[model samples]
Target chain A: MRIVRTVADLRAALAGARAGRIGFVPTMGALHEGHLSLLRAARAENETIVLSIFVNPTQFDEAADLTAYPRTEDRDVELAASAGVDVVFAPDASEMYPAGFATTVSVSGRIAETLEGAHRGRAHFDGVATVVVKLLLAVLPDTAYFGAKDAQQVVVVRRAVADLGIAAKIAVRPTSRDDDGLARSSRNARLSPDERRRAAAIPRALGAIRDAAAAGETDAAALRARGLDVLAGAGIDPEYLAVVDPDTLEPMQVVDRRALVAVAARAGPTRLIDNVEIDPETGR
Target chain B: MRIVRTVADLRAALAGARAGRIGFVPTMGALHEGHLSLLRAARAENETIVLSIFVNPTQFDEAADLTAYPRTEDRDVELAASAGVDVVFAPDASEMYPAGFATTVSVSGRIAETLEGAHRGRAHFDGVATVVVKLLLAVLPDTAYFGAKDAQQVVVVRRAVADLGIAAKIAVRPTSRDDDGLARSSRNARLSPDERRRAAAIPRALGAIRDAAAAGETDAAALRARGLDVLAGAGIDPEYLAVVDPDTLEPMQVVDRRALVAVAARAGPTRLIDNVEIDPETGR
Candidate 1:
């Protein structure tokens, strides 16, 4: 695998990659199974696979969280290589933001205002959208792989790619999970050992919401209440637990069709979010 | 020249155009000498030239201005073909925005605030940046030509392209003007014959500011005062008259090295904007 640290080098590598189908996976490096899953998907699907590790400062709503975020580069490169990634792009913040950087790409409206977006503020999504565009343009990937773990992020990115008329396809892989049912995330490692045990409630709460919806309880408020009760029952108070349209992220009053039940909660100084799409008929 | 009205057709045409350097000129399609200048520059510098006429509604703060905007498609195609344009993309607003379009590209901070941006609001710039990105990604041109007549517009678009890490190079052509020296613009057609004659004050004011700065006028306020004086002498009250940093568009306190002297005035219901870059050393 080749490691490129500069934009010029990244583009030079991509110039030769145009003849083949290129698949991309962008991440903040900690090299968890969630990231590996995306890389593996890209590897299986394209003749060329590129993964980028950028601890984008703009996306972090809290400075301490950014500082506390894990950085395991050597292990990450090894993990990427094992996952069959052909090129690993590790760019510093200076290269991405350079001096006089004043433009930002934003996805607004309902999708930008609920759940995690409401808690973290629009800057988080702005950071995500901007960096994603830069990465997509840098590689001009034929297909970009994203895990459904960050479901809202997938929605925002899809909106950007489609709205901007970007000439690329977004392939979302299934969310990777731990044996405890906790969604696999870099933040999962941040959980204290005991806190890790409690983290399973986050996904379970979403699962319970799906169960209620599948059982013909389609009231949006009731579905949300059921999910909240699961978290509340576990001595956990979630930031938000709501039912929303899968695409627009607009809160729905009733689950008349497929909807996304998302959850966000804090456990022992770590913030974790997980979501599931609930078909009104099947529930999961 | 072939006229392509759909994004799919445009992309299909561009796919085969990759072997050669493509130059693009995006326009509102009133097709005056101003747009012709950009087309001519693109024609000279590239093997393939793609011109688009999309009077993006999102960019217009006034619905009336959008409605009033001239669009002569048949004549536009004829002019483009005569100027050696290879492809003309004339997409309707629906073709561009469609339904569920929720993403926007914006340039914030000083550049987005002064001049036309400050006068028209950020929505004007937000619309411009969003549509410009869509067009740039649509064609993936080697170079895109823009006229310096809309000087601040040039700055905002350049900032967006650079900040987004878009691959295309931005080439700013010299502003085209009438024999009387009024800047060439589609909006210029909105002026009454008498209003057209008065429009000369716009450029004359900018010229007077440059003359003052060239002749050892180092005070920023004094430079702006002189520019404003010329407009005032013509019985015109400008929306804004100032000397600012060329790149950031921040109002300068003193003409230390170089500054942009800009003005906007309404003459008989038509708004006209003009600017000139003046270096304390060269002044023109």
Candidate 2:
């Protein structure tokens, strides 16, 4: 795998591959099984697979969280090489946000205000959408890979691409999880053993909601009650437990079609989020 | 000029021309001399010139203004063809904003909160930035053109392109004006013949401010007073007359380097905007 640190170098490298199809997977380093899974899908689907690992500072509302977020650059490069990655774009903050930089991409309305967006600071989705656009343009990918772990993010990104007339197809892979049922995340490495055990409740709550939907519980308040009970029983206090339409993300009183049951909880000092998409029409 | 009404058709036409450089000039289709001047610049600068005439509704704060906005499609096509435009993208509102459209581009800060942005209501610059981005991505232009008459728009678009990491290089031309010194605009066609005579004061006021700055008058308030006096002398009640740094658009008390003297006023029923860029250091 060839590693490039600057945008110019990446573009130069990509210039030759313009005629071929490219699959891009953008990450914030500390690659886990989840990120590897995306790389695998990208590798299988396209002639060229480009992975970018830049822990964008603008996305993080908390300074300490940003500073403390794991880097693990050497390991990340090793993983990408082992995963058969073609090119890796690892841009620094200075490279990503140069001097006099003042452009931002924000996706607002009913879709952006629910679930993870509600508890997280206001500009989180804006940062994600902005950086995603920058990366997509730099890579010029035919298809962009994303994990269903960030289900809401998939919606936000899709909306941005359509709204901005950005040309790229979005492919979502199933959320990766550990044997203990906790979603795979870079922040998961920061959890203490007990905190890790408690974090599993996040997935457990989503699972219960999904199962309840599968078992004919269509009311949102009832679904929220079931999910919140699972979290509380496991001593994981949730920031929000919501049942919303998968696309618009507007909270639904009755699940008429496909919907998402998602949760965000603070397990010790770390915040964890997990969600599952459900199709009420199929009762799953 | 090949007229394409849909984004898909435009993309298909642009695919074969991908090897060549594109110069994009996005306009609201009234076919005034100012827009034609942009077409001339685009024609001269790049291998292919793509012009988009979309009067985005999201930018208008008032409904009547949108209803009354001039749209001279046939004349616009004729003017563009005569100016040597290769393609004209005249998408209707439905073509530009399809169903389930929920994406917006906003550039906020000191630059977006002054003059036209302040009085025109919020979401004006946001709309321009958003639609401009949509057009840029659709055509994938190497260089994009803008008129300096809407001086703040240049700053906003420049900031948006840079911030979003868009590849287009922004190229600005001098504002096109009529023989009477009134800036050429689609809205100008709405004015009565008498109003057109009085509208000359808008640019005349700007010219006076430019003259004062060249004469080494460093105080901003004095420059504004001189500009407003010119407008009042012609029966034009000004909405705002201010001296600002051209880039940041922030109100300045003292002219430091290059500054902008801009004004917006109601000449009878039509509102007009005009400005002049000044280098106070050299008193230009």
- Clash count for each candidate, listed in order shown: 0, 1
Which of the numbered candidates is closest to the native, going by highest TM-score? 1
Residue-by-residue lDDT tens digits, candidate 2, B1-284: 69999889999888878788899988888878888888888888788989888888988888988999998888888888888888899998888788877777888887877788889965899888888888888888999999988888899999988877788999999999888988988899899988888888888988988898888888898988888898889898898888887878878899878888888888787788888889966767
| Model 1 global lDDT (CA atoms, 0 to 1) | 0.88
Candidate 2, residues A209-242: lDDT per residue as tens digits?
8899899988889988988898888797788887
The alpha-carbon lDDT assigned to residue A200 of candidate 1 equals: 86
What's model 2's interface RMSD, roughly to a tenth of an angstrom?
1.2
- State residue A134's C-alpha deviation in candidate 1, in Å: 1.4
> Model 1 - which docking category?
high
Residue range with the least summed lDDT across 10 consecutive positions in model 2 chain B: B275-284
Per-residue accuracy of model 1 over A1-284 as CA lDDT, tens digit each: 89999888998878788889999999999989888878878888899999999999999999889999999999999998888888999998889999889889899887876777899998999999999999998888999988897899998999999999988899898889988889999988889888887778888888887777778898998878887787877788988887888887888997898888888889988888888888976655
lDDT of 1 by residue, B163-239 (tens): 88888999998889899889898999899888887789888888887778778888887877887787788889999
